[model samples]
Target: MDRHDQVLEVWREFIATGKISNEKILSPAIMNSWKRSRECGVDPYQKKVPVILKEHKLKNLLERNKDLIEICRPFIDNLYSFFRGTGFVAALADVDGYVIDVTGDKEVLEMTSRGSFVTGALWSEDVAGTNMIPIVLRENKPCQLRSTEHYCWSQHRMSGVGAPISNPAGQMLGVLVIFGPYEKANPHTLGMVVAATHAINNYFHVRRMLTESQISNKFQKTVIESIPEALIAVSNEGYIALANENARKRLSLPENITGKQIRDVIEPGNGNFLSIISSKNNIMDMEVQIIQDRKPKHYLLTCNPILDAEDNPTGKIIILIEIVRARTLVNRMIGAQAKFSFKDVAGNHPRALETISLAKRAARTLSNVLLLGESGTGKNIFAQAIHNESNRAKGPFVSINCAAIPRELIASELFGYSEGAFTGSKRGGNQGKFELSDGGTLCLDEIGEMPLDLQTTLLSVIEDKSIVRIGGREVVPVDVRIIATTNKNLKEEVKKGNFREDLYYRLNVFTIEMVPLREMKSDIALLARYFADKMSARFGDELIRIDDDVISILTNHSWPGNVRELQNVIERSISVSLTNVIAVDDLPPEIRKKPAAIERDVSLKAMERQLLLELMQSKLSKTEIARKLNVTRCTLYRKLKVYGIPYQ
Candidate 1:
């Protein structure tokens, strides 16, 4: 007989007599397993392997072995694909010899069901009586059992091969098994099973390393973003590797700048900036000038070499600080912050309160504001209040009076100056009102008095939100909110060619007309009391009370100097008054001499008529004049008819 028939005869003889007469007919491994099975009292006539895992226990087992099954599933499918329709079946089992997964030909699977060859069935040597799974688990190596070689009589018609799958540490995690009919058993099946286990082990290791790398990268990104200064990482070969948000914003860099050359992003200033990064030594407090937006910006740079385990350079860490930001910090410490908010503005007149409401609304936006009123109307107070009320309240509140600064120095004062810009320029340089007010508000007081030549530059700066210092080629960016105040009527100035029309329109985005004290005379008593209390505290005295006669005199006078004149009168009264109660006798002689009934109505009407006549003579259309006066066409027409002025 052939090898199969001879092995079958030997297996029956061993089972019947409990001994093998010719030991050479069967391998010593198979003989030994049969001897062990008998010693353990395994039933030679058993028909099926018992399903040891219950539903709940099987679920827990699957979950525990999920990674192993996942890694081995494709390999199992591939192995089955090569032997499909040949009566072959493929399955995976855990270290305990319980089948966890299975796949096979439909007909073969149906046939195997009679023997309980399914998932969750135990196949240990004593229970299953020497199947391939038990053999591989016991031997810890590739194993094949064919026909009668299986100790149990139930599996005499089956043949199978199995291999132990282990992790990189060489500990067996599970077993891969492939089996078919005894008649089709081939030695090559064992090789295929062994190869698949090796492949699964390698793939598992790769997946674990990738997961670790992703976690590490996330941690590094978090640390980089937390740093406030501009930070960049460059590879040893000079390619950009990483940059933080601050670096991207301060340098105006693109979101994805990695892999680009370092020189491409930062323009070299006084020295070669890339060379400093490439140097082997660490650097600190090195002043560097880098051109951005066509303007040179100064930075205090620091660099440190990043080395590998062997001390070889792998990359570098570079930190950059804007020098202007340091100067701004000092400026803020000295008194650049806004001290007044909307709560500080105290007025009770309807018109005055309405103006405050408008200023409060203006503060909520980034639009430029124009405060139009006479001098001493607390326009500066409203300016400061707006700055304090804005979202940029944390930044500086810088004010530059166009009328106060000399005409020749107005441009440099407004835009800033470069080092050695002119004969008397400061040694390093000076930041202009715009730069100093970065991330805050810049109050251009008396904007109408600004030079005509400089108005063009101002308009450009307002539009572009950038400026180049005097004699400087580089452009510096600023985030300043503009709040301009002026006593002159800008529309008349624009018509007379004194102010640029475009500049006027730009600054007039949100107009707040500060009411003259005479127009809001109802608030005079209230403002007088506020000023009295304020001045009294300044003089280190108790809150002063104003007399009824003093309030009456203050309310009747036409305050051409507006709220400022009222404040001065209250201060004078407080200083000279003998008692805490201010009296009419304590008032200034000029205000006291002024007549109460000044006939302001007739003069106001006359001025309105003159204004209408001039506007009518100008190039503006009726609609334009109506819009400029902030009135409807119907109202303008009625006013023109009342004055007997011509209108078509």
Candidate 2:
């Protein structure tokens, strides 16, 4: 029989017997496909191919596999070009055997369209019965099928070659198939399909690797940008590769400084990153200087080398911290913060209350403040209280005593000098109180003792809101609030040419006069108790109590040293006292011997009567009073009874 009659005979035998014993008549691949088709119950006589997906479903499927379609489109078009007039059609199908793309000549397209072999057609074994697309998908290998090898009778006139397309993981993604009339089939067509499928799989692998690399680069950039310290990464040749936000601001670098030489952006100085790179040694905490806004500023630099897999240095990562910021942190660690507030100023006397009220008002503004009072009258306390109550409370509170720092160094101490500006100047210079107290308060204690020459510079700094160091020409701007304290009257000093008149008016913009302990005698008792309790804790004793007699003596004495002196007396009394109650005899001789001023008056008899009446109201026993007055207990009781003071 001829080929056509033989194909018909084989189909009839498989339908009737469910087996094929003719191995020489058909290849092993075809015989196996025939067995699978029979077990699946496909009818060899079935003619019409069922629609697998309607228009909308087909559109959705194509959209879902858009990447695969895109990757296979040009290859399919090339395959069609190779067989342009040969009546061949090249098609691509997913692993499920649904044709997602097709390209072919008009006549071949029309011929396949009739049998639903066009795009969106289902060609699986269960649907189309052992076609090339289904067999290739099942075996995940390349194969060719001709004429009667197809199980369905309708596909007996077609021959096709198919190859599986797989991802990098070796799992089959789809199949590439070229189908045409059996008369046009070539032996090398299946090899071409196999080669094209590998090219498609390679494209998938490369595209996935590129996508993952882009994602990883973006994540690394994000992490670098989130760091707070100024960070710069440079190539081994010293060209910048990356920089963080703080690095941009601190170095005043322009955006997109990448690939620019590091030396071009940061002026070379101590801890030069390029030098460190040459040495190939990691350096840390190296002080350096950079010129920012035409002014020299200091920074602490740390650099670490980036090494390649071979352990050779490839790049460097540099970290920069502003020196002023480091000093501010150090100051905080050393208790350079305001610890007192208005509530800690223990007094309700009218003068004290008025001073507190004025300070509170001063805290609301950014004006300079001048605290005028005798030493130990809480001038420093009021300054700190104002700072803690102000909007800048969270910032540092730097106090520098003008009298403590020598006149020759006061200028350099207030406005830092540059390197080589003076003998013994620290390397990279120093940031003075003004720079250290940026965005905070700087208390210039004992402003009266400031030299007349320095006072002139102070006036200019206050007027211009900037300062030039003693030997430096660069103008450094400061945003510090000036809080000057002095025991001497600045207005009087200005007249005597000891202080500048312009600076006096500037600092006196908001003046607060602290009340001395003697002037606020009513608060003396409360202050004594407060100090006693504080000292008791320091002495590791029970909270000390002040007797009424001791209070009376404290109220009567002339406290020349103000609150500070009173605190010392309380601490001393607590240290020496035999009991927790501070008594008249526990007091220092200087305090005890200093009798009430009224006792030395010419009207001694009246003063004595007033003293007796005052002592009578106290909680002190008669014996304590006798010891305090330097008289016998019998005399104390007789005098109190004579003054008509109650014995109780």
Candidate 3:
């Protein structure tokens, strides 16, 4: 007999005798499926599929598998076109074996409908018996079941080929099936289904990859924009690729700066962008300038090259920090910030208070201030207090001692020098006190001591509110408030042609005369206790008590070094005093003197000897000692001889 008749005969025997007597007539996969179907209690005589799903449940199943059905729609139509005139039905089934979609010739569709082989019908082996859909879904591979190979009698006259539609990982998502009359059974049908499944899987993979790429790009953009510093990305070809908000604002660039040339947007202070791209080297804290309103704005720039797998430059990433902000951080790192305010200037004397009050008023304005005082009279203290109390209190307080820096180097120290400006100038140039003190205060200590030539530059910078570095032509703008302090009377120095008369008058607009300790004797006791308390806190000890005698002796002395000398004495006393109470001996030897009772009882000749001893032990020169003693050099020599004192 024919193969179909032989398969039918075997099926009948297996159903009636519950065993395959002619197992050789059946393939291993078909025979195994037959055994499983029988174990599931499937009726071999059933006329139709027994597991048709309800309408609502089938609708829900189709909704869940919408993507699969949509992706497979064109492929299914194309596959069916090869057998359009033939009696074939193409259908898609979910992993659960429920048919979700179907297309077929009208006549074959009608015949399959009668067997419950249409959409929404379950076609698994347990319910429909040894069909291609269930076999392929279970095996996760393609299969063809023809004629009596089907375990159920209703499906014996039909044949179907099915292949699994799976993800890239090879896990089955569903099956694609083509059913035809028993005469049309062919192994080639399985090949067609598998080819379509592959096409669907490729499309699915591309769609997933595109989605993930979009997500990653968005995340990177968010991170770049969140940074506080200006950020930019540029292609190696010099085109701007990306710029964060801060970058656009800082560079004064348009909102849509992408595709613009890098040179058109930025001006490098060192070299051209092309050279930088060709070098492919990282740049750190390189100075650069961007022009806005015909004036250049400075920034500290950092650049890192983006490299490909071969380590070749693909692009670059850049970060920009405004020069003012950068200098502020540098000032903090170098201890250039002010630490005193108006309240730290200790004194209740009217002259002292008046000077402080005038300084406060000067702090409120933008004019230059000049502090006149003797050495150690707290002129620098007033400068610091004015800086902390000014509008630029939060900014840097850079100070340079005009008398301390050598005359040869003071120009570069005050106005800075360009790279290679001098034999030993630094690379990338240097920021002078003016640039470093931008938006802050600059205390030019001992201004009268500045060289005559440099004083002209200072006057010009003060008047123009800008400066040019040595050997550099660019005029950098500065907003520094100058507080020039000097012990030498600037007026006298100007009369002697030792200082620039024009510079003196320019800085003398708001002058404060720091009161000396000798002139403010009434405040000595108060200032001593203040220093004592401050020292005690610093040394982690109880405040030292200043005895009345100690204060009296300090009050009587002429403090040529002024308030600074008093502070040093107080600190010294606190350091050496065995007890918390400071006494007359705690005073420096030069400051000590006999009391009123001793002065009255002592002989004039003996007192002169004691006075000479004190002056000799101090740092005073012979001329200064003679002046202090109100004696001519000739008479002072005679006195030193009578007292048996040696002279240099």
Candidate 4:
């Protein structure tokens, strides 16, 4: 029988007997769908196609499947172009089998719209009964439906081909359908729909990967930028691939240096950063120098290799830090920090209290400070205390002894010299104390001992706030607070032509006289106890106690070396003392003999009086009497005159 006659016979048999005896007259796919439609209680004589969603509901469904609809739009448009004259309408439906979008011949769309076969129409087997969209969605496969295959009579003249669109994981997302008249239907039409849906799925997979890559790159860039240290990433080929904001600023690099060779940017000389990329081994804390504005600055470099999935080196990451910052870190680790505040000065003697009050006031100003005191008085301690209490407390406190350095090299030591400025000069030159102490305090200990000529240069530096290196012409400005300590009387030296008068006056702007230890005798016991406690920690023992007799001896002896001498005596006593309590016997020989020395001075005075009295009685001449007394005539006459005896 002809195809129309066969379709008619199957329809009639299924309706009359509630089953189809002519199942062999149709394709297995179509027969199976027809049976499913019948089991779903769909009638072959039904006239109306079900509307799944209208207006607002349809808009909401389209919005929910927006990604699927967008991915299939372009592919569906191209498919429609190939079948433009074939009366086909390309439609996309959600996995629920509701038509979300349709595009095709205007006349064919108009006919489908009248039968509720357009957008928002339900085409599921249970709703519209046996259509390509519903059947493809149900079976999760491609399908072809001929005219008589549709269970509803209203769709008897229509043919549709559809395929379920799925993601990379093979989970169905939606269906792509192409519908036209039954006369134009072919197996190839279904193949075309299946191929188009595959292309759309590929687009979805690629787009998802691109999105994830973008998110990952953005997160990486943010992390790199947030780091405080300079960071650079170099490719295996030695070209810079990425640099953070800190790296760019530190290297003085342009906004974008990607793909530029590392040597062109950093000019690695001693660091050998490129070797790390090849060796794939990490190198840390390597000191490297880079020249900027014709002067070299030091930086510590750390390089770590970036490896690929195969465990082979792909690139290297570089971290850079200025040597100054590294030095600060080292200083902290070694306890070179300025830990003493004004509270640590430890004394209530009026002179000591007054000195502390003056120091605390000086700590608030930026003027130069001149600490005048005898040796061993706590000048260095006061210097550090002033620095810690100042606004620049966080900065470094660099101290250099003027008397310690040789006169010949003191000039270069105070003001750095340039490269090749002198023999034995560092390759990149060196930063002087002034530069090193920038934003901090520089204590010039024993400032009186500074040479006469260097004082003139120092005066100029103080006036100008800048220094020219001994061998170089570059003028480096420094922001350092000068705290000069001197044991000698600068005024006397200036008068004696041994010091520059102008420099002396300039440094004496804010003079703080550090009280001598002997004058503040009341503080001796307190300071002794303090030093004993400190030495105990170093000696790894319990705190040593000072006996009252030892304190009395310490107070009685002349501390010519000031507080420093007391500390030394205390430390010596602790070392020799067999017990934890320091006694008078543990005192140094000089301190132990002080009382005898005082008694001996009184006896010697009485002996001299008797000897001079006897010499006058013998009637010796002034010269003879002076010679007998082992003194000069002037000294002997002065002694006789002060004693109220005859000088003649």
Candidate 4 C-alpha error for residue 345, in Å: 1.5
Model 2 regions more than 4 Å off: 1-227, 233-236, 239-299, 303-317, 538-540, 593-648
The candidate scoring highest on TM-score is: 3
> Which model, 3 or 4, shows the larger lDDT?
3
Give candidate 4's TM-score: 0.50
Q: Ranking under TM-score, best-scoring first? A: 3, 2, 4, 1
Q: Write the per-residue lDDT of candidate 2 for residues 32-53, one digit (tens) a residue.
A: 8788778777777777567569
Better of 1 and 2 by TM-score: 2
User: lDDT (0-100) at residue 612 of candidate 3?
Assistant: 84
Query: Each candidate: RMSD to true structure?
Result: 22.0, 18.2, 18.4, 23.4
Q: Rate the local accuracy (lDDT) of all candidates.
A: 0.83, 0.82, 0.83, 0.80
Error of 2 at 424 (Å): 2.5
What is the per-residue lDDT of model 3 for residues 195-279, given as tens digits with 9 covering 90 to 100?
9888888877887789789988998999989987899889888799999999888767788889998777664542443464345
Clashes of 4: 0
* Per-residue lDDT of model 1, residues 1-648, tens digit only: 888788878888888888898899877778888998888888988887765688899899899998888888889899988999899899899898888898998888888877888878888887878788878887888888888888888888888998888876778898898988888888899899889987888887787788779988887898889887899999988789999999998787888889997777664452466666678878775656777776677787888888899998898989988876765775677687777777878888888889999999999998999999899988999999988888988788988889988999999988888878999877557778888888888899999999999999999998999999999887888888999999898999999999999999999999999888898878888889988888766766657888787788888899988888888888876665545677655678787632464323344446668888999999999989988876656657756876788996
